[model samples]
Target: MAWELATSCTNQRVVGSSQIQNEAMQIGRKEIKLNTTSRAYVDPDRINELKTISSESFDLSKLIRLCEELNICFAGECYLSMVMLTRAILDHVPPIFGSSSFQQVANNYSGAKSFKEAMQNLENSSRKISDYYLHSQIRKSESLPNVTQIDFSNNVDFLLSEVIRLLKK
Candidate 1:
């Protein structure tokens, strides 16, 4: 038996919907998103997926921002930022559920007060995942190479879907 036969490939998510739109401009920590009206929203790009649907049941803006950041991370070719945004979104949503269980997280979204504060709390939380590259500003010869764009993109896709599923619940 060969190593290829013994080792199995596992791709949990399909990398289709998490791609950047054909028309988007990347700026520093921001993206200029072109809307149908020929307008752009600056910073924390809000490209709403459910633009037609009213979000009276649950907040949709944050989820959309995740999508936008994903677009920015890819369009801008910054894997580190993409990873950060994805992980941050996951970390932030726990409070919405009132618990940190995104594998089907605990969310009491109805009890939620402020979106901004919730995000801040999670950002400051201990479970927040940090990128090895960004944290290791002082690169060491022994340190491993930075995460590849493909890996980051796939992770974003998986995490995005999981968060969306949790929200829809």
Candidate 2:
């Protein structure tokens, strides 16, 4: 038997074997274009590198998603979202390093000296920046963060590289 589904002049044909036909009929096609004038703060190649790590014992879904969203927010110039997402990634990945907090990860993780330093920068600077944005209230005078104020890509890349190393082991 065959079935057909139709909506708004679009039709899908289903076969008896539960297969969907590749070709569908459309009465009219509407095209919508979006603005493409955006830039990425975190290099997309770094994000792609994180996507390559997979481990049976560890679930990196949330961590990877946070990195993806952080890049998107940065590209959109949403510095607040970028900062919050950066902090969230730090908070969420501690357990992967066998630590309860990013501070502990910075202070205790048995890695290279430079790696620990990067983590410390993230734990201190990024956390403090995000805290200010998360906890502050509206006032008569307010200052918005520019790219320079929220640029933490190098530290984040270092952290992600460490994560990949740990997971691959």
* Model number with the top lDDT: 2
- What's the residue-level lDDT of 136 in candidate 1? 57
Q: Per-residue CA lDDT of candidate 1, range 25-71, in tens?
A: 22222332232221121122223333333535557666665655454
Stretches of model 1 off by over 4 angstroms after superposition:
1-20, 24-58, 96-98, 101-129, 140-155, 162-169
lDDT string for model 2 (1-169, tens) is: 1112212112322111111111121212111121222244445565666667778878887776677666445434467888999999998999889999999999999988999998999999999999999999999999988767777877887888778878874
Q: Which pairs, if any, clash in model 1?
A: 97-106, 97-107, 97-108, 101-105
Cα displacement (angstroms), candidate 2, residue 23, comes to: 28
- Candidate 2 regions exceeding 4 Å error are 1-38
In angstroms, the error of model 1 at 132 is 1.8
lDDT of each: 0.40, 0.67
List, in order, the clash count of every candidate structure.
4, 0
Question: Each prediction's TM-score against the native?
Answer: 0.44, 0.74
